[model samples]
Target chain A: MTDISAQDFHDALVAHKLIIPVGVPGAFGRGPVFEDVLRRFGDLVTEAAKNDTAEHMLFPPVIARRVFEKSDYLESFPQLAGTIFSFMGNDTQHREMMNCVHEGKPWGQYQQMTDVVLAPAACYPIYPQLTGTLPENGRLVDVQNWVFRHEPSPEPTRMQSFRIREMVRAGRPEQVADWRDMWLERGLSLLRRLGLPAEPETASDPFFGRGGRMLAANQRMQKLKFEVLVPVLSTAKQTAVCSFNYHQDHFGLLFDIKTADGQVAHTACLGFGLERVTMALFRHHGYVPAEWPAEVRKVLWP
Target chain B: MTDISAQDFHDALVAHKLIIPVGVPGAFGRGPVFEDVLRRFGDLVTEAAKNDTAEHMLFPPVIARRVFEKSDYLESFPQLAGTIFSFMGNDTQHREMMNCVHEGKPWGQYQQMTDVVLAPAACYPIYPQLTGTLPENGRLVDVQNWVFRHEPSPEPTRMQSFRIREMVRAGRPEQVADWRDMWLERGLSLLRRLGLPAEPETASDPFFGRGGRMLAANQRMQKLKFEVLVPVLSTAKQTAVCSFNYHQDHFGLLFDIKTADGQVAHTACLGFGLERVTMALFRHHGYVPAEWPAEVRKVLWP
Candidate 1:
C-alpha cells in the first residue's frame, strides 16, 4: 500500500472542500476544485488524442440490456453488473411495496426487470455499434463516459461509479496490437510530462470466481492487458491510473465486425480513469491546483 | 406536430452519419458531429452561468437508494424511476439464474436491490449533498450529468436516458426565486442567440397516475415550474428544452438543509436537456453544423 491512507485522502478532500461525502460509502459530490482538475485532465487527454483523428462519441450511462447480454459480460463478471429494475406492479402491488418500505422490509421483489443495464465499461457500447463491415482503414473511437462497477470501497480511487476516457481501435491484428503498444508509450510519456511518476506493466481484469482465474492467467500470459500504475493510496499497492487492453478478435467476432477484406477485425483500447488520475495528481503534488508544480500546471492548464 | 416528421429527423441523422442506431429502439450512439455540438452546447451554458458564480459540481449518475427513498420520488414519479438491482444469489441460485437466462425466462427475481439508484435528474444528487447547514451566502451549484427516465419513445427528445445540464440554487425563498427568474431570462436569451425560437411557459413534471395529475395541476397553478420550450418534435406541442423549478423548502425539509439564520433553505433549479436542445438546434438550423447560420455558428463554435 502507499504511504498515504484512504482515510488521509478522504480527510484531505473534505478538508480542502474539494469533495463532499454523501452518507453513503464511496459516493461523493465534487466541488469546483475537483471538477476543475477533472475537466483539465479530460481536456489534456483530448488534446493528446487530437492527432489520432478518432471519432469522438458519447454514450448514456445506462445501456440496453440486450446489448449488454450479447457482451458475454455476465459469464466473466456478473458480480460487477447492475441491472435496472422498475415497478411494473399494479396499484395493489405498489401499495404493498410502500407498506413494506414503511415497515422496513424488502420491497425489491415488487420491482421487475427493465431493458437497461448500467454500462460496465466505457468501450462496451462501441463494439455492438460497429457490428457491420469496416472501412478499408478500419476505425478508431474516442469515448468518455461514466462507468459503473459494484465494488464499494472506502478507497477514494476505487469508486463504484467513475469516469473513463478511452480510445478504442478496430483494425487488423497487427494494427490493433501496434496501436495499443504505441498508446502505452504515449500514455506513460504523457503522464510523466504532467509530472506524475507512472509505470506500465502487464495486468489482468478482476474477473470473478473459479473459471475467471484461468481467464486472468491467460490474459496475463498473452500480455493482452497492461496498466499504468501511480502511487495514490499506497506506494506498495499502486493504483491503475490507466489501462491498455487488446481484445483482439473477441468483440469483433461477437459483434460480427469484419474488415473491408472480409476478415474479422481486431480491437484495442487505452482507458484513463479520470478520477484516479486526478487523485494521483493531488497525492503527488498537492490539493491546490494553482500551487501544483509549474510544469504540471502548464501541461494541464495550458 | 413539427413541420419535419420524426422520420425525417431520423433520416437526416442517419444521412449525416451523426448517429448510429444500436438496434434498441430510441437508443443511439452519437458520432463526432453530435458530440461536438453537445460539448459546445455545454460550454455555452457554462459561459452563461459564469456571472452567476455557481460552483461547478460533478455527481455520479447513480445515487444511494436511501437518498432516493427520502426524496419522496416514488410518491410522485415512481413510473420514471430506475432502481439498480444485483444478483445476491447463492451458488445454486446463480446457476438457476443462468439457466433461466439460457432458457429465456425472467430471472430478475434472483436479483436483489442494491444500495444505489439511477439518478432521475442531474439536480437530484445535489439536494442530499447539501443536507447540512448552508454557508452565509448559501450555495449555487452547476451540474451536468446523465439522467435516466423510464419513458422510451420514438421521439428523439423523449429518450429513456439523456443529459441534463442544471444550475441549482439554495437560499432564502426570494433569493432562490429571483435566481430562477434571472436564469430563465438568461436561458431564453442564450437560446435565442443560438438562433433557436424559444418561449417560456408554465410547465409540470410528468407525475404518475391519478394522484399525480392533481399534483401536476397544483404545481402549474402555484407557478412552481416553468419551462423554456422550442418546437422540435412538434410545433403544436413544443418540447421543453429547459426547466426552471422552485422547490420552496421541499428538499430542505427532506434533507434538513438550513440557512445560516436557521431558516429552511428554499431551493430552485434550472435544467437544460442537452440532447433536446441539440435536437432543437438541428431542427431549426438544418442538420449540418458547418452550414448553420453565421451568427449561430459563431455563437456556438467561437
Candidate 2:
C-alpha cells in the first residue's frame, strides 16, 4: 500500500465500487460497503451452516447474567466487562428513590438482580449448551451475535462494542488444535485473497487490569495466541483481523463439556472480525473497491 | 417447518452439526458460524465500497448529545437513547458518587458534558458534514456501524444492539429514490442467493407511542414496510430479515441536506441485519450447521 491523502484514499474507495459513509459518531463507525459485504458473505456462511450434521441455532445478544457468572468471566476479567441493565421502578417509585438521595440518606436495596448483560464475547452461548451434550468427539455450532467491552481507545483497534464471528470446538486436545489450525489457515488465505498481507502473532485474553500484566507476559512467553495483522494509518502496530485461540480445558471443565466417551474435552476457538477485514481491504486495495483484483472480484461476484 | 419439541429440536441441532453449549446462557447467544458469516459478507462489502463513487470514512459510536437535541431523537424516542457519559470526579468524589443514595444528599457533580451519546442512526453524522458543503449532485454516503435500541424480545426478533449496514443518500429526491431502489433489488437477490427467502415490502419506521401510531399505520396502509420473512421454530409469522426505507426528505430537511441548487435533498436508506439473515439460515436448515446445502458450501468454500 502506498501513502495516500484522505481525499486520495476516499476517491479510490469510490472508484473501486466501495460505499463509504460521509461520517459517523465514532472512528469505528461503518459504511455502505459494510452491509453489502455482510450479505455477500452471509450467502456463503449460511450454506456452511446447513451442510453439516449440527443443528443451526440462533441466539440473543443478552445472556443470563448467571451464565457469565458460571464461566468465571467476571472473576477473570472484570474491567473489560460492559454490564448492561436498566432501572425498573415505576415513575412515582423512581421519583421516591431519587428524592431519598436528595435528602442525603443512604438508600440501599434500590438496585435489583441483573437479569441480562451485554455479551462480552461472541462464543458465550456455546459453553452452557455444551454442558449436557453426548458426543465424546468434537462438534461445531453456527452462531452470529454482537459483543461488548469497555474499550476507551481512539484506535478503532478497540471499539467499545464490535461484531465477532467465532468458530468454537470442544473435543480432544489434538482435534481442537487441528480445527483451530485449519480455520487459521483459511482465515489467512481469505485475507491474502482480499489483497492484504497478514501475519500471525501470539495473542492472549490477558486476565484483567493491574495483574493482567502477568497474563500478557505469559502469552508473550508461550506464543500461544495468534492474530492476523492489519495496519491502520501507517501505524507500525497492526490490528488483529483474525484470532486463533486454544482455551485448553478451562471452558470445557467449567461447562462440563465432556467427550462423547465421557472424558472432559479440550476446547479451542477461532474468531474473525468482518469490519476489520473491510478496513484492511480499504488500506490494501487503495480506496477503490470496484477495481479490486480479478480473483477477489470473482468470488465476490460469483 | 414443523413444530419440534425442545428436546427433539436440540437433537436435530446435534445431528445437523450444531456445537451447542452444555448449558447456554440465552436463546440468541453466538458460535462458529457467527464470525464466519460476518467475515464472508465483510469482503463483498469492501468490494462494494471500493466500487462506489463516494469516499468512505469511519465514525464514532458516541454522538454529541447536542446532535440528538437538534435532531429531536431524544424527544421522539427517549426510551431508545443510550447516553454516553462517565462519572467525572476525583477518586474521593467518585466514591461518593457511587455511594449516592436516593434519600441521601446528592454527591458532587457526576454528569459532565461528554458531547456524545450512542448513535441511534448512521445518517445523523452526514447531516453535520453536509452543512459546510452543498454538493450540487451525487451526494452519497455508505456506512456500517453498531446501532443501539431498547427492544427486549429474545432471539431473532430483538437484540439490545446489533450491526447496521446502511447506505444513506443526500441528494435530489429522484437520485435518492434511484439509489434506494437499486439497493432494494440488490439486497433481495443477495438474500435469495443465501437461500433465505425475502420479499421487498414497502416499510416505515415506527416513530413511537400514540402519535407515532399514525406513522406505523401509514406504513402498514401504504405497504411501505417491506420485510424478508422466514419461519424458525415453525413456519408461521416470518421474521423480517431486511427493510427498505424512504425517508422522503424528513431527515434531509431537518439536517439541511441541500443540493448544489440550494434545495433540501431527498434522502433514503437501506438497512441489513446480519444476525437476522444468519438466524433465517439456521431456522431453514436446522440447528446443526454441518447439514447446509452444497450450494451454500460452494459460496463459503470457493
Candidate 3:
C-alpha cells in the first residue's frame, strides 16, 4: 500500500476493467462492478440518514445562470467553475462552425452562453429555494447530484465531473453547528465501519488569490471545515472522502434565508464524495467485493 | 385531461410543488415526492430488465469531444449539441472575465471549449466501447445517464437535459433486429402494466434541414425507429415515453465493431425516458400517489 501511487492505482483500476477510460484525464466511465459498489454505498448512506426527516430533492447537474451569479462562486473560485455554452446560431453561423471544423480551427468561439452553469456543488441550488423564513428548528435537505469542476488531473480520485451526496441544514447557528458536528462523527463512523482507516482533520476550500489565502487560514483557524481522510492513492497524503462545512451565514445572507425568529439563518452541509469512497473501498478491501470483510459486506449489501 | 395543455401541466406540477421552477424553461428540480416516485420507477425498470443479463455501465453526462466528433452528430443535429466551455486562462484573462461580469457584458467570450461535449444520448458512448469483435451472441449493455439537447421549450417533457435508461445491443443483423423487436414489446408491456394506455408508432429522429427531412422520411419508410406514445400533455397529440431504434451498421461501421464470425455488426437500442414516464404517471394518475390506483402502486413500490 505504501508503494502505491495515484498513477499506479489508476492504472490498476483500468487494467481490472473497473473503470473505462475515456481518454480524458479525470473523466472516465464506471464498469458494472464499480457501479454496483457505488450504488450499494449510496444505498447504505441513505439508510444511515433515514432517521433524520430531511426532505430529499434531485437537481440536474446544471443550475440557473442567475443563481450562479448570485452565489458569487466565480469570485471565490473562478478557475474551477464550468460554464455551459451552446451553439445558439442560425444556418449561416452553423455553416461557419462546420467550416471551422473542416479547417481544423477553433469553432467554440461561435458558441454562446446558455441560461445555466454546471453546478459547483449539490447544495448550492438548495439555498435559493430557502429564501424567506424557515421553520423554528431548521430545514434539512438531502441532495445527490452530479457536480462539475474544471480541474483535470491524472489522479482518478480528482474527477472533473463527480457525484456528491449531501445533507444541508439551514437554521439557527447552534442547530447548524450541532448538526455539523453530529454528521462529522456519523460520517467518520460510517466510513470506518466499511473497514477504511478514516480520520477527521481540519480542511479548507481551495480559495483563489492572495486574499483567498487569508480567508483559507481564517477558515482553518475557526475550524469551519473538516474532511474525513482515507489513503486511497497514497498513505502519506490521504484523500478527503467526506467534507463537513459550517458556512455561518454566507449562503443565508446571500439567498435571504431567514430563521423563524427573523435572524439570518446559519447553514452547514455534510458531503460524501461517492466516487472517492468507492475507490477507497476497492483500495482497502480489495477490488472484489466478495473478498471484502464479512462485516463490511453486511453493512453494504444489507 | 382533454383541455389540458403543456403549459397547464407545467403550472400544475409547479403548483403542486412536485417540480421546483428554476426560472428557466425546460429545466427544473424534482421535489421529494417526485423524486420518490422517480426512484421507484427506476427500480421497477431495473427489475424488469434484470433477466436480460446485460452489463450495466454508468457514464457522466459529458463525453469526450473526439467521440462526439466521430459520431457525426453535428452533421445532422448541430443545433442540438451542447459544447462545454471553460475558462482555462491566467490571472489577466480572469480579470477580463470579472470585468465583463461587472459591466454586464457577454463574458462567455473568455471561455474556451474543453475536451468534452454534452452527450446527446445514453448509447452514444457505448458504441465507441464496442469497437472490436464481439462474442458469438454479441454484446448487450445497460446504460442510464443524463443526456443533453439544446432545444428549449415551455413543454416540461421537452427538457434540454434529461435522463435516459437504454439497453444497447450490437451483433449480427438478425440478432440486432430480434433484440429491438423484443424490447419494443417489453417497453409497451411495462408501460401498460403501470396502467398507462401506451401504444407503439413509427418514429424518426429530428434531423436538420431539407436533407434531414429526407433522411427522416427514409428512416420511417425503412421502419428503423418506433416510439411508445402516451397522452401526457395532450390527448390529441401523445408524447413519446420510450423509443426503439435499429441502426443497421450505422454505428458499427463508424466504430469498426465486428462480429465473432468476421463480419460487420449491427446495432439497436431501446431507451426509456425516465423523467417523462414519471411525469406521465403523475398526469394519468392523480397528482397524489396515495390516491392513485392500487395496481399502479403495487407495480412501482413492489
Candidate 4:
C-alpha cells in the first residue's frame, strides 16, 4: 500500500463523485473516504453486472429481529451482532419508580423492545427474501448494504460497520459458482484497475469468542472464502478489497430457497469493502492524491 | 397526495434498477437515491457555479459538540438533535455494581449514553471546521450528511433519523447568491428529470413549540425557503423532496466564518430528501416497479 497525505486524499475525493453529507455516518462508521472509494466500486460492480444476471439493489440500513431468528442468527452468531433496542416503556416506567425513590419524578413512556437489529452481514437478507422460490434458471442479485458487526475496537480497515457492496447469486450449483468466479476475477481486475496489487488467498471471518477461531479455521480450510489482499499501512499483513464466498446449501436449507421446480438453491456471493479499498488507494498513491494514476481517477470521476 | 398500495410501490421499484430489498422496510431511507437526484441537481449547480470564483469542496461527518453549542442549537432545538456522548471508565464501574446487585438473579445491564450521539445534520460540521478561518474570496463548500432527529412515529416519508443531502455555499454576498441560484435551478431541473410534479412553496424547519407555526408562516411570506412538494398518502398535505433556503448571515455569525477581507460569509443551501424522492417515484409509478418510466430506470440503473 502506498501512503498519501491526508490533504491530497481529501482533494482526490472532492475531484471524484465520492462524497456524502459531511456529518453523515453509515451504520458501521464509514467515512467520506469510503464514499469516494465506493464510487470506484459502484463502477466496478456496475461493470461486473454487465456480464452477470444480477441487478443492483439497496436494502434498509436496519432489519427486524424476527428476520434473523427465522434465519437462525441468534443461535449461530449472536455476539458479533448489534441489536437496536430502546428501553420498553414499561421498563422505563419501572426505572421511573427507581427514579422517584431516588429523586421523586414520574417518567412516562410507551412499549418498546429489541425488535430490530442493524444488519450483521451483507448476505443476511438475500436468503430470507429468495426463500420458498427460485429463479427458473438462476437468479443473481447485486446489493450494497450498510453492514454492522459488534467488534470491541476500531481499526481503519475493520470498521464495526461498513458498506459491503456485494454481487450474490442463488441458482444451480454450476451457475452460482460460475458467477462467483466471474465476480472474483472482476474484483481482482478492479483492484488492478485502481493500481493496487492484490493476492487471492483463503480468508476467514473473525467471528466472536473461543469457538469462533475453530469456525474460522474451518472456513479457511474449506476455502469457503477468498479475499483480494493488498498491503496497507504495512507490508506483511495486507488488507482485502473483496471476498468471494460459496455457501453451498446453508441458506438454501434454512430459508428453503428452492428452484421453480423445487430444489434448494446454491448460493455464492462476492463482497467488497469500499472503505478498505479507499484506504488501500491512499497508501498506494500517497497523501497527495492529485498524483494518483489517471487510470484510477478516470474510473472514479468520469 | 396519492395513496399507492405497498405491493404496487414495490413493483414500480423493481421496474427500474429501483430494486428494493425483498423484506427490508423503508427502502426510502437510503442516501444513494438522494445523491443521484442531487447529482442531476448538482449538474445545474455546477453550471450555476460558473457564476462564481470559488472552487468545490466536501466535508466530514463528525462535528465537535462545542461547535453546536456556539451555534445556539441547545437553546433553540435541543430536542431535534442527537448529541454524541462518550463513555469513560464509569460504565465498567457501573457494570461491576450491577453484577453484584444481580448476583444469583437475572437482570439486564444498563449501558445508555455510552457513546456520542450520531450527527443530527450536515451543516453542523461546516460551521465549526470553517469558523476559525474566513477566506478572503469567501468560501463556498457543498456538504452532504446523514442527519438524525427524534420523532416518535415514523411513516414512509417521515423518519426518526434520515439523510439530509445539502448543497451549501458560504461566501461574500454576491458569491453566495450566485451559488444559491446555481443550486436552485439545478434542484428544480432534477425534479423535472425525475418526472415528479412539484411546486416551490414556502417552508419552515420545525422550530421549538408554538413558535414553529409563526416561523412556518414567515417562511411562506418571504419565500425564503421553497419546497418541492410531492403528494403522498395524505392527499391534503404534500411531502417535500427539495428545499431552497437562504440563511443570510445566521451561520456566518454563529460560526464566525468570514471572508479573508473581513465580511461575514453569506450562506444558502439546497436540500434534498433522498427518501422522499424515492417515495415520489413509488407514488408516480405505483408498486409494480417493473412498470416505472424507462428513462428514470435508464438513469438510475445505468
Candidate 5:
C-alpha cells in the first residue's frame, strides 16, 4: 500500500474529479469514476451473497418518526440524528419565511418537524416490519439503504449521508451469533480477496454522553460488535469498512419479534460501508480503477 | 380498465401487502413484491436507454442548499420543498431538546437547516455542475434519483418521496427540442409496450400562487411541458407517469451553461416516475406479478 497521507489522498481524488466538493464537509458528490467502482463493488457484494436466499428489501432514507422514537436512537446517539423539517405553514407564515430568507435570517424557525426522520441505520425500519413470529428458519433480509449521521467532517470517508449494504438476520440467539461469526469471516475474506488488508477487530458504537461510555464498555466486553478495518485514511487510525453487529434480542424485544420456538428473537447484521470500502479500494490500488490489480479487476468487473 | 376508486385501489394494495403503511399519510414502506417490480422496471428503463450513450450519474436524495436556492424552487413550489434539519447544538441544547421529546412538546426549534435540502428533482443538481461550455453533441445525463415533494396524501401513488429516472440534455434549442420530442414518442411507446395505454398530453407544473398561474398558462401555451398520462388512479383523471420538459434557456441562464458555438444552451429533460409507472402496471395487470399477462411479464422480468 502507498503510504500517502489521508489529506493527500483526498486532495488527489478531488483533483482527479472523482469526488466533487459541494462546499460541505463530508457531503461531496461522487464523480463518475467513483460511482462506477462503488456500483461494481456493490455488485460484487451481491454476487458474494447470492446463495444466502435472503429476502431483499429497500427502504427510503427517511424513517417514520414513531419508529425513530421507538428505536431509542435519540437516547443513545442524540447528536447524530437528522430530523426532516418542512414549511407546513399558512400563507402568512409562508410570506414571513420568505422575508426571513430575503433578509438572510434563519428561516428554519418557520419549518416544523415532518413525520419522518433521516434513518440513522439501514436495519432500523426492518425491525418494526418483523414484529410477529418469524418462520422456522427465522428471517434474513438483504438491504441497501441511504443512512445519515450528523458527524460532519473534512475526512472523505466520514460522509453525513452514505449508503450501507447490510444483511440482517433475526432468529434464536445461537443462529444470530453463528451468522455474525460467519459474516465476520466472509467479510474479511471478501475484502482480502480484493487485495485489501482488512482485519476484524472488536469495536463499539459511538454512543452519546457519560452513560453511553458505560454502555460502550459493556458492549465491548460482551463482544457485541466487530469491525473489519483497513488503513484507508491513515495507518495510525484505520477506518471501519465493514461491521458485524450482534444485537442479542435488543431489536426483537423492542419490536416484539418472536422466534419459531415462541421466544424473543435475537438479531444480528453485517453491514458493508459502500463508500468507505470503495475509498479503501481506491486508496490501496491508486485512484485509477483501470490501473488496479488484475485480480481485483476481474473480481469487481467480471 | 377497472373502475376501482383511488381509495379502493389503495386499500387493495395495503391488503395485499404491496405497500405497508407506516402510519404516515404518504410515506409507506414498500413490500418485497413492490420492490421487485420497481427494480425490474428500473432495469427495463436502463435497457431502453442503453443505446443513448448517456453518462449515468446517481445523486443522493439531498441537494446542496445553495443549488436548491439557485433553482428558485421556493419561488415556484414553496409548498413542496422538504428541507433537512439537524440537531447542531451544544450539550445544553441537546438536553433541552430531549426534555421536549420526553414531554412530547415541540422540539423542532432545536433543529437547524443543514447545508443540504431534500432534492426536489432528479436533475436540479446536474444543472449547476454543467456551468460551462458544452461539446458539439452537448451533454446527456442518465440519472435515477430519489426525489422529494411535500404533498402528503393517502393516495397510494402520491408518495411524498419517490424515485424518478430522467435523461437530461443541454445544447442548442433545436437539439433540446428534438430530444424532448423524441423522448415524448419513445416514452409513450415504451409505456404502451408495457400495456399501459399511455398518452402524451400538454401539461404545466403546479407553480405557486397568482404569478405562478400566469407562468403556468404561459408554459402550456408555449408547449414547454408534456406528460404521458395513464388512467391508473382514476378513469376520469389520468395520472402522469412520464414527463417531457423543454426548458428553453431557463436552467442555462441560471447555471451559465453555454453551447459549443458560445451561445446560451437550451435544456430539456424526460422523466419517468418509477413508482407511478409501477403502480400503473399493477393496476392494469393485477397486483400479483405471477398472474400478470405473459407479454408484460416478459418485458418487465426478462
Candidate 6:
C-alpha cells in the first residue's frame, strides 16, 4: 500500500513544478520535468518492444464518426465517450448559440454532430485499417497516441485526455495469444526493473449499467482482460498502469480481418496508460526525479 | 500552381503506402515511414529552438471549459471549435439515448457539458497558466501537442485533428515582437535548408461572421500575424506551413499576466503545423524519403 494521499500527490506535483493545472480539475499542462520523464519512459518502452518486430505508427487524436460508429463503442461505453459537437446553424441559429453562451444557458443544444469523434482508445483506428487479409504470419503494430475519456476527477492519474502506448497484434489465435502473454511478462519485468512494485491481475472495463455488469463479469470470467497494477493512491485500491486485452476475433469479424488461411484473425493488445505510469513513478519514488532510487534512476536516465 | 488535385495527393498517399484511409474519407492511419519522418521533423524543430532557452511542455488535448470560455474562442472562431460532450443522463435518459442511437436519431442531446473542452490550439492552455506575474525577463515555453479543429474537408492537407509544434514567449512588447520576427526568419531559413521553397507573408485566422472580418482586418493591419507559405497541394494557392503571431498584450490582459515593470506582458508565438510541414516535405521532395534530395535527406534524416 502506498502512503501517499491524492492531495499529497497533487501538492507534490505542483510544488515540484512538474504539472500546471489549467483551472480544470482533471486537465493539466505538464512542465519540462514531466515531459522529460515521459519521453525517457517512452524510449524505454520502445527499447523493450524492439524484439516484437512491430510496425510503428502515429495517428491523430480524433477519428471519423463513421469509423467510430462501426467500432460498437457507443453500445459498450456510451457513458465515457466524447463526441465532437459543432454549431452548424445558419446565421440566425449562430446568433442563438452566441446568445445562449453569453447568457450562460444550455448552448449545447444548438450544436450538431461532426464527422470526427474523439478516439476512445489508441488502437481503435488501427483495427479498421487492417480490414483485409493479412500476410501469412499476420501483423503487429506499435502505436502511441492521445486518447480521450470523460472521467474528470482530482486523482491526477485519471486525466480527461491521456496518451496510451499500445502494441496491437493480429494473427492466428495461438500466435496472437502467445504474443500477448509474452508482452505481459516483458511488461511486468520492465516495470519491476524500474523498481515499481507491479502485479498482473484479471480486470474488466468500466462497462455501462446493468447489462454491462454481466458483460464485465463475463469478460473477467474469460480472463480476457489483464491489468498490471501498482499502488499509487492506496495499497488496497491499486491503479492499473498497464492493460492486456484479447479481443478474440471480435475485431476481426467487425473489420473483416482474416489470416492468409482465410480464417478470422485473432487480435490482442497491450496498453500502457502513460500518465498513470508516470504518476505511479512519482508516488512510489519521490516527486523529484533526482531523489528516486539509484537503480531506478540508472534504468530510466541511463 | 502545382498540378496535383486533391484526388491526386490522396492516390499518391495510398500508392506510396504512407497512409491508409480507414473507410473514412479524410481520416487516415499513418505508416512507419510517416511516423519516422514526423519524429525527425519534431527533433529538428527542437534543435532550431535550442537558442531560445524555452522550457518544453506537454498538455492534454482536453482543457477546462472555464479556461476555454475565458479565451473568447466562442466569440471569435466558434465554427472551428469542438466541445467534448458526454452522456450524463440518468438511467432513464440512458435508455432514451440508447433508443435514439439505435433508431439512428441524434442522441447528443443526452450529453451534458463536462468541465473540459477540446483545445483548438496548442498555445491556448499556456496563457491561463501564466496568470500571475512573470519574472523580470518573462517566460518562454516549447509545446508540442495534438489540436482539434472542426473543418471537414476532402483536402488531404487539412486534417480535423493534427499536431502543432509551437514556441511561446511572454515579455515586454518589443521583446516579444523581436522574438517573433527573428523566428519568422529562422523558420523560413530552416525550411529553405530542407530544399523547400518557403516564403513568409502576412496572414490571418479564419475568423467567423461579419464582425470577425473586421477583427481579422485589424489583426492584419497591426502586422500581428505572419505565416510561412509553401506550395504543398497547389503552387497557385500555397499552404501556410508555419505561422508567427504577436499578440501585443491580448493574452496578457485576458490571463492577467504582468511583467516585472507592472505592465501587461506582451506575447508572441511561432507555430509549425507538423502534418502540414511533413506533407510539404513529401510534396516538394518525393513521397519516398529515400528518394528525396540528398541535402534534404541529410538535414531531416541526419
lDDT for each candidate structure: 0.85, 0.59, 0.88, 0.60, 0.86, 0.85
Tell me model 4's lDDT, rounded to 2 decimals.
0.60
Candidate 1 lDDT over A168-188, as tens digits, reads 999988888888888888889
Docking class of 5: medium
The candidates, ranked best first by TM-score, are: 3, 6, 1, 5, 4, 2
Against the correct fold, how does model 6 do in TM-score? 0.97
Per residue, candidate 4 scores C-alpha lDDT tens digits across B139-207 of 655555555554433255665445566666777878777766766666666677667676667777775
Best by lDDT: 3
Worst 10 residues of 3 chain B by lDDT: B1-10
Please provide, for model 1 over B120-180, each residue's C-alpha lDDT reduced to its tens digit, 9 standing for 90 to 100: 8899888987888899888998888778888776677778788899988999888888888
Better of 2 and 5 by DockQ: 5
Fraction of reference contacts reproduced per prediction? 0.59, 0.20, 0.64, 0.05, 0.43, 0.78
A43-82 per-residue lDDT for model 5 (tens digits): 8888888888998777887778888877778877878888
lDDT of 3 by residue, B60-106 (tens): 98888888877778877987888888877777787888888877788
Residues A1-302, candidate 6, lDDT per residue (tens digit)?
44777777888898888888778777788888887788789999999877767887777788887778777787778878998888776667778887887777778787777778888999998898788999988999889888888887788888878899998999999999999989899889999998889999999998887788999999999999999999998889899999999999999999999999999999999999988888888778878899999999999989
lDDT of candidate 1 at residue B221, scale 0 to 100 = 99
Each model's DockQ score: 0.66, 0.15, 0.69, 0.14, 0.55, 0.72
Q: How high is the lDDT of residue A81 in model 1?
A: 87
Clashing pairs in 1: A1-A234, A1-A235, A2-A234, A2-A235, B2-B234
**Prediction 2 TM-score vs. true:** 0.61
Provide the interface RMSD of candidate 3 in angstroms, 1 decimal place: 1.4
Better-scoring candidate (TM-score), 1 or 4: 1
Which parts of model 4 have CA positions greater than 4 angstroms off?
A1-38, A68-116, A148-155, A172-174, A287-302, B1-116, B145-155, B159-164, B172-197, B207-226, B232-235, B245-256, B261-266, B278-302
